[model samples]
Target: MKYLEGIAEFCAVADVGNFTGAANKLDTSVAQISRKVASLEKQLGVKLLQRTTRSVSLTEAGTQYFQQVLPALKVLEDAQLAVSALQASPQGLIKLTAPVAFGEAFIAPLLNTFMQKYSGISVQCTFSNEKLDIVEQGLDLAIRIGKLEDSTLVAKKLATRHLFVCGSRDYFKEQGQPRSIEELKEHSLLVGSQPYWRLFIDNKIQSIPVQGRVRYNSGNALCSAAVAGLGIAQLPGFYVRKALASGQLIELFPEYKDKQEAIWAVFPSNRNVAPKIRLLVDFLAQHLVSDS
Candidate 1:
């Protein structure tokens, strides 16, 4: 219990690598933060932080202690949030990120409606494929698709999506349908930013290389070209559903579509999930369709 005195300051310094940053985070003077941390080390009889002139880092024991305390702190925060959920007003600026194409097509519209519903809240959105550091970048939330990488961030599945290899009926008739993965090379396979396509074959996932007359980084453009009978292109269900339904595009290898991918809303695990943040996530989860 004695070591718990500076737990918040210690964690903040670990996160930002400086006492000045930790003081700024907790709204205290650097001297007070430093004194508290020194007293904590004395009580625990361990050097938790390895301090340098320019930066601070956690010792091995400090790392272990931090991991244990962080979750306990989060649980305490959750209890507080649950009690205040109804009392708090949703009034704040939320900064978030999402995939470029999906954000433009789906998330942007929902955000517009959310802002209208909560007149006091505003939004700042960044659309990019690069995995930006949410904690370092100070982002409140991030919307990610497909397989998520291993990280310390907390994620909530918002929806599901599917991928398919598709082409126009005219192109299929002229080039012939590909019966197997190897047969893909014999036809015009429109390439995307990735030179290879992932397909489910024989109950296993396989990355098969594909080549074609057209290459586009944008899924919308690929879908349009496939609809215009240019060549075959693999795209997500949301992009080709209308085309497939209208008979403009035919789904090739119907049985081999990749397993349903999850769309996620992620945020830094260390921060408390504020009322406004939770509200936006709940809104998105309620609105985003889970259908493939």
Candidate 2:
């Protein structure tokens, strides 16, 4: 273990076939590498290299030593590289994709914090409600909510996006709060484009089909319309927590509220994922979880 550095230098010089080339590749002086290899031979109590004034070749012992230790040395080197890469603050451009509203409202601010901590990192964020093929699009990471359909990507659950069946206080008082799922059909339902809301009931997932006078794809639109006394809409807690707390919107069905679900950071599998993606995923997960 103590002579690992020496072994590494010896391997490098042997592999490159010249001390100058090895020194250049290792970013060190040839003299230092030569000394380390000499030290390694002394420590091993055997001559491992046969060096000429102009060129160097492995001796029979050196050849045997190089063949055995070379691969293990490379493995040690790769391990060191991985550790060093992890220790350094992640750098490079990280392209991220997310839902339009969630990215702007939640993820963007957290990304600002991430950028401040990792000044070397640059980010390009695209906000679209549409589901994207992250690998084909060459995205570094993506934020997805609800149930994931793509099994190819690795999904790290960031936080629970607690949803609410909500209405304005005025509308709830006038229409009367629905005490059960069966009564929800009687009320004026405001539809998101998805047209269905999933809830957990009796240890099972229940999908409720709904209709409304007004329909919109955007969560913000649904939230804003509901605030303006449109009707009941199922929306995420982040979209309406402040409103509910401020009495702008009233959360309905406290007894039956089981609509909390997860947000995930998804990325494609790679042989060796760059530090940039790792940092972002970790930072996002930490920030989102802490905030929640």
Per residue, candidate 1 scores C-alpha lDDT tens digits across 50-83 of 9889778899999998898888777877897777
Q: How displaced is residue 60 in candidate 2, in Å?
A: 43
TM-score of each: 0.75, 0.69
How does candidate 2 fare on TM-score? 0.69
What is each predicted model's overall lDDT from 0 to 1? 0.84, 0.80
Off by over 4 Å in 1: 1-13, 17-88
Worst lDDT run of 10 residues, candidate 2, spans: 268-277
* Each model's backbone clash number: 0, 0
Tens digit per residue, CA lDDT, model 2, 131-244: 876644557678999788888778888887666889998888788888888999899998986788777778776788999898998888888998998799988887888888
Best by lDDT: 1
